[model samples]
Target chain A: MDEGRRPDDEKGEAEETAELLREYERQIMALPVQEHVERMLTTLSGLALQRLGIGEKEPAACSPQEARLAIDAFRALTEVLAQDEPERGGVYRATLAQMQLAFVSVAGGRAAGKGGAGATPETNGEDDGEAGKNGEGL
Target chain B: MDEGRRPDDEKGEAEETAELLREYERQIMALPVQEHVERMLTTLSGLALQRLGIGEKEPAACSPQEARLAIDAFRALTEVLAQDEPERGGVYRATLAQMQLAFVSVAGGRAAGKGGAGATPETNGEDDGEAGKNGEGL
Candidate 1:
C-alpha cells in the first residue's frame, strides 16, 4: 500500500501547503499599506544619517552622494504620504529636515577637512543651529 | 557699455558655476563606496524595526512584508560588504539577526492578537531570549 498508493499522500501534503499559503496571504492583506510606507521612510532616514556618519563618529567616512540619494528617496515617498496621510507625513517631514541638517553638517566638515569653504557658506558649527532653523537648501 | 560687454561677464559666471560643480563632484568622489553600503544596511535595519513597530508601541502597525523587505535588503548588502569588509560585515550580520528576531517576536504578537498559535510555536515572552540566541529563520 505504501509503495503503490503514495499519490494520495502526496496530494494531501500539497493541499496542506496550499492552505498554509492562503492563510499567510490573508494575514498579509490585513496589514495597512501606510504602515509599510512609514517603515520605509524611517529606514531611509536612518540610511541618510549613516551616510552622514551621524552616530559613527567618523566624519571622514561620510558619503554625501549616498546621503543625498537616501534623503531624495525619503522626500519622494513622503510626498506621496502627504497626499493621503498628512499627519504622518508632517512627522516624516520633520524627520527629513533633521536628516538634511545632519547631511549639511557632515558635508561641511568634509569641506573644511579639505581646506575648502565647501558648498555651504555657513560651515561653522556655530551656524548649524540657525541653518537648520532656516531650512537651508542642500 | 552694459549691452555690448555682457557676454564676457556672462561667460565668467558660467565658468564660475562650472568650477563650483567640478569641486562638488570631486568631494563626492572622495567618499568611500563601502561606507555608503554600510550606511545603507544600517538604514535597512532601522526600517525593519519600524515595520515591526518596535519603537512605536503600536504593534497593530506591524507590516511583515515591509519588515521582510528591509531585512532582505540588509542581508543582500551585508553579503557584499562581507566580501571586502569582513569585520563590518560580521557586525551587520549580528544586527541582521537581531532584526530577524524582532520580526519573529512581533509577528508572534500579531498572531497571538488574532488568537492563533502563530508561525513560531514558542510565542511566549520568555522564549524570545533563546529563540534569538538560536537564530530562528524568518
Candidate 2:
C-alpha cells in the first residue's frame, strides 16, 4: 500500500503539471495575433529604453549596439504595420519619431564623450575645441 | 499573336507578384523567433509611450485605457521572458521598472489636474483649497 501510494502521488503531480501547461498553451493560442504583436512591441520598446539608458536607474546599462539593433528591428516591423494597418500606423509613426529623437540625444552624448568618434576632420577639430572649453569650464 | 501576348503578359505579372510574396515569406521565415519577439517588444513600448503621451508631440493622443493595456501587456510578456530567457530578460525587468515610474508620474499629474479625483476627503479638501488660491490669483 505504501509503494502504491508513492507511485500515485508522483503520477498525480505529473498530471497536474501537464494540465497547467496545456491551460497556458490554450490561453496563448486564444489570443488574437494582433495582441501578440502588441505585446512584442511593448517588450521591444522597453528593451530600447533600457539599451539607450533612457529612464534607466543605471546609466551603465546603455549598449549602443543592442540599442541600434532594437531600434532597427522596431522600424522594420513598424514600417510593415504602417502599410498593413495604416489606422494604427499613425501611433507607431509618432512613437518612432520620439525614439529617433531619444537615439539622437544618446548618440550625440556618446560621440561628444568620445571626442566625436567618426566625425569629419573639421568636425573633430571643432569638437576638440568644444571639449577644451568644457574642460576649462569644469 | 497579339492575343497571346496580352494573356502571357497578364500571367507574367501575376507570377511576378506571387514570386515577390514568396520571397517576402521566405525572408520572414528565415529570421529567428527571438528577432520577432524583440521587434514586438519595441512596438509595444512605443505604443505605450504614445498612449501615455510621454514624448508625444500631440497631447491629445493620451488615452489612459490604451496606456494601461499596453503597460499590462508589456509586463505580462516581460514576466514570461524572465522565466524563459532570463539572460535577456534582465533588460526587460529594467525596462518594466522605468515604465512603472513613468506611469506613476503621469497618473499623478492626471489626478492632480482633476483636483484629486480619487483622493481621500481630506486630500480633496486640500486640493480644493489650492485650486481656490489659484482661482483668486487669476
Candidate 3:
C-alpha cells in the first residue's frame, strides 16, 4: 500500500552489504596471519598497478583521487616495511619507489594537463639515496 | 634396546614446534581480518616505540632481525587495507604517519648517538607536503 512500495528494497540492499563485509572478514580470517599479510601486500601492489594504468586500456585508469590514495597506501606500507626489517630494509623502499614512479609517470601527466595536485612520487630519489647511504654504512 | 633415549626427545620437540605453529595460526584465524590488521599495526607501533626507548628501560628492545619481521608483517597488512577501501585513503596514511613520527622522535636520537641506520621517519615532512599539495588541487 506504500506509495513506492520500496523502503524494503533499500533495507535489503543494506543487509546485502553487511553480509558481503562479513564474508570478506571471514575469508580473510581463514588464512594464517602471515599468509594474510602476504596476500594483502600482493593485492595492494596489483591495485596500485591497475590504478596507474599498467595493464588497462587507459593510461592511468583511476581518477586523481584514487592515485593519491594509492600513493599514500604505498608509502605508509613502505615505511612499515623499512622500519621493521634491518637487513631487508632497502628492498621494500626500492619496490615502493618503483611503484611510485609508475604512478607519477602517469599521474604527473594528468595533473599537468588538468591542473591537479598530484602525489609527487619524485621524492623516492632522495629515499633511494638515503637507503643507499644506509646500505654503505651497514 | 635404545641406548641414549635421544630419538624420542627430538620427535617430541618437533611435535611441539608443529603444535605451536598450528596454535598460532588458529589464534590468528579466530579474529576478523580487520582486527588482525589493527593488531598488527598496533604491534608494529609498540615495537617501534620499544626500539626507540619510548616507554621501556631498554632502548632498542627488539633485535634488528625481529624488527625486520615486524615491518614485513605491518607492510603486508597495510597494503591489504589500502586496497580494500576507496574512501579511507587518507585515514590509513594519517594513522601510519603519526606512528612513524612517534618512531622518529625517539629513534632519531639513538641513531645519531650510535651511528645506526635510521628508519627515515624524517620523510614524513615531505609526505605531508605532498598530501597538502594534492589536497589544494582538489
Which prediction has the highest lDDT against the true structure? 1
In model 1, the clashing pairs are none
Chain A TM-scores of each predicted structure, in the order given, are 0.61, 0.70, 0.52
For candidate 2, lDDT tens digit of each residue in A88-124?
A: 8788777877776776677556656666645533454
lDDT at A6 for candidate 3? 91
Candidate scoring better on lDDT of 1 and 2: 1
Query: What would the per-residue lDDT of candidate 1 be over residues B7-67, giving only the tens digit for each residue?
Result: 8897898899799989985555444445545555666676677667778665654566556
Give the per-residue lDDT digits (tens) of candidate 3, residues A1-138: 364969788788789979998998655543333343445455456556665566766542454334344445455655544443445547656766787776556655555444334323343332221221222111
Question: Stretches of candidate 3 above 4 Å error?
Answer: A1-35, A58-61, A116-138, B1-138
Query: What lDDT tens digits, residue by residue, belong to model 1 across residues A77-135?
Result: 67656754589779888988888777777765565664454434354343232233233
**Model 1 docking tier (incorrect/acceptable/medium/high):** incorrect
* Global lDDT scores for all candidate models: 0.61, 0.58, 0.49
Choose the strongest candidate by DockQ.
3
Worst 10 residues of 1 chain B by lDDT: B127-136
**Pairing residues by index, what is the TM-score of model 2?**
0.41
How large is the interface RMSD of each prediction? Answer: 8.7, 11.7, 8.8
After best superposition, candidate 3 residue B95: deviation in angstroms?
Answer: 12
TM-score of model 1 relative to the true fold? 0.36
- Candidate structures ordered by DockQ, highest first: 3, 2, 1
